[model samples]
Target: MSVTIETPNAPLADAQAMNEVASSIGLDWVGMEGIALPIEIAGRPVSATVNAGIDLLAIENGQKGIHMSRLYQALDELTQSELTPALIKSTLTQFIISHQGQASCAHLHFSGDILLSRPSLLSEMRGWKAYPFEIDARLDHQWMLTLKIGVPYSSTCPSSAALSVQVAQQQFSLDFDHQPDAISVQQVSDWFDKRGLPATPHSQRSWAWVTVTLGQDAAQFPVTELINRIETALSTPVQTAVKRSDEQAFAIANGQNLMFCEDAARRLYRALNNQCHFDQVAIRVEHQESLHAHNAVALAVWKRGSHAA
Candidate 1:
């Protein structure tokens, strides 16, 4: 019978003395990443990949490294309940307190696709939509938080609409072989009924990515409101589970609200600028043009102050 000796708990590798040279340099950020964390947002358990880090600027001369496990433990303890602004602030506090005199900064980054239900236009039916979102929270001398979201919409080119109208007028002249002063109203009506449209404008799928610095209660992300503003500004949103009526309404809206990349960016800029809750806002509009092989992109930023970021 052989007995194995248990490893002693004392004199651990973490308890070893630090090298003077190695202990002198301060680390800006050090900690865990890709931590599988489930956060509760708006009563839903949100699966998030969290990146937690902290600055070891206050490390004493004798200390070689800060305890990385402390940050993870802080996250685990606070996240067991739920994720909220207050909980985030508390977790950062725990990270600083765990180090006592070593750490002065803490940051947490989480990103995931949140599932939300959106109602169909001109229909009572609703469908689920997954929106990619990112939330970044930092704590140091002050606290900061920002949220980013992606919104997909339709962009009808103004130039393309004008050109289409011009071509349709020429097509009408050729089809009837008569001028407005000579053709009867009944003849024009019959021609329109037989031929659906002389020419159709070219449009393509588009996207808008927006970021906002939040200054209010962050218990829930304002994804719906942000999406509404973006779609309203552009006047043409990509439909989900589109019915015939919804498709017709969408086509009419697209025709009424023709825009280019620059127009899209400016409209979003103006829409976000009116919101007081967002301290700093930025938007990028991407129009995947069906007319050209290249995409048209525009970015705009607006701040609460005299400048933009």
Candidate 2:
């Protein structure tokens, strides 16, 4: 008589719902992060990693962990449509709606690259350039959107430029000190062809990482316009496609736009200040020194009036 009675197929208890703990004292952000999803940026399908979170107060400590699965599902549904400011706002709103009275703020972060065809500096050829960009959206008492980008350009040190010019002058005097007549074209060309006759300034590939927050006046994300302003301000953006003529032109541009990290930061700080749409701007300029072992770095922040951060 050792027959076993059949048990019920499933558990009769909902552990996650019934097992409740004390409330959290203060949790600034709580949610899933590094969620890999496919999203559309600028009408192109791109892979994006999403980080979403919500603030948990002491009154609502730990019930079921803020329904994290709901936040993930909301973002996953957004991959079907192209990412825009409106979509971000809607997604953040959905988070609050789904959480009801549990969450007061919702935040989302995603990053991807935008591929663009950039025309050559001097040639008619165009080449593809991939620009890494990131967007942050937060919905609480107010809505905020921020964009960040990294621009690479050539940086020639001011001191190096002066020294290079002096070197060339010394070499020229050594070659034609006794000549009474002006140097001929052939003679100047030969002087240039000589090895190490005119010292070239030391220039290194540098980077500018800029983050800007849009004020209420801004309607759409001005990605292309922001990129243009940065590139034009630096004046020595790295070239994509190059020919002999293009290389020569680039050399002249570099000579004209010689800068240090301080100069680069100042240039961007002023440029961003003039834009009404940009309320707060953060600039970081890094020069990977070709001559020195340490890098040159400069940082500047521009905030509107007394609201600066």
Candidate 3:
């Protein structure tokens, strides 16, 4: 009681291949963004968001669109190995090869948070800290790689500390004015215990954004090394596992290493400039002030041959 008609065998339609373009204008970049992927960083696997693209130069020849699926497939296949300069170069090469004559340049960007076990300042305890980092790669005339990282630290305002000290001195003078002859080390200690300081300097959590242009000879991303170097130079890296002793040590470190945003920028500039791996470096430091509505910031840049080592 039922009859069915057979369908004809025909090639599927491809609009990207068959459609005519409205204009022959070329695009600087064309591809995918916010692709979820797993990438190895610092000898561990972490989830990353990636963006892949290539220049659509063949549009001048009336090419309507690029094969975006090819870019996705290439990223899915090539990112299995540990991320390194060699791997990035290979990925970019695959992008160009997949598009053949349609693309001459390729770009890749990926970002992830890396977890590192950090020891307590003055204790045997340790805890984890996550560092957010980004890697950008491009291949045109030659390969170029850039590494960027955000580092959190404590910034104590030098001016505020000085003012705090002056207020403390004035308070001490007023308290011991009537008993000048009775002033002794023990009496002074007792007075400090009873009255404490009238004022305390303000400190706030701060950040340093470090960007570096890696030389072609760079084998791997130096994320941990760069973080350590910056933390050491600034000397007030935010703590993770903190005992009372560790907290006191951190407070002492902040007191001894008071700096403004400009000082932090200069310290990072000098620290990174001494390294031979980077051809250029840029630094931006931000102090999230507790006293003001606006944040304090400083910027600095260094080139390879422009400065003497």
- On TM-score, the candidate that comes out on top is 3
| Candidate 3 residue-wise lDDT, 263-307, digit = tens | 999999889987899988989999999999999999998888877
Q: Which pairs clash inside model 2?
A: 23-61, 24-61
Measured against the true structure, the TM-scores of the candidates, in listed sequence, are 0.87, 0.88, 0.94
Off by over 4 Å in 2: 1-16, 60-62, 180-182, 195-197, 306-309
Q: Write the per-residue lDDT of candidate 1 for residues 20-80, one digit (tens) a residue.
A: 4565578899888899988776545678899988887644465767777878877886457
Model 3 residue 178 lDDT? 87
Off by over 4 Å in 3: 1-9, 58-61
Estimate the overall C-alpha local distance difference test score of candidate 2.
Answer: 0.83
Q: Which candidate number would show the highest lDDT if scored against the true structure?
A: 3
Better of 1 and 3 by TM-score: 3
lDDT, each prediction: 0.81, 0.83, 0.89
RMSD of 3: 2.5
lDDT measured at residue 19 in model 1 versus the true structure, 0 to 100: 40
Per-residue lDDT tens digits of candidate 2, residues 1-309? 698757778666544344245665656799988989898776667777889988865554355557788888898667877777788888899998987867799999988777777888888977877777888989999989999988888999999999988989998898899999988998888878884546778999998888989886565677777778999999998888888888899889998898999999988887787777787888999999999998999998888774342
Residue 174 accuracy (lDDT) in model 3: 88
- Kindly give the stretch of ten consecutive residues in candidate 2 with the minimal lDDT sum: 13-22
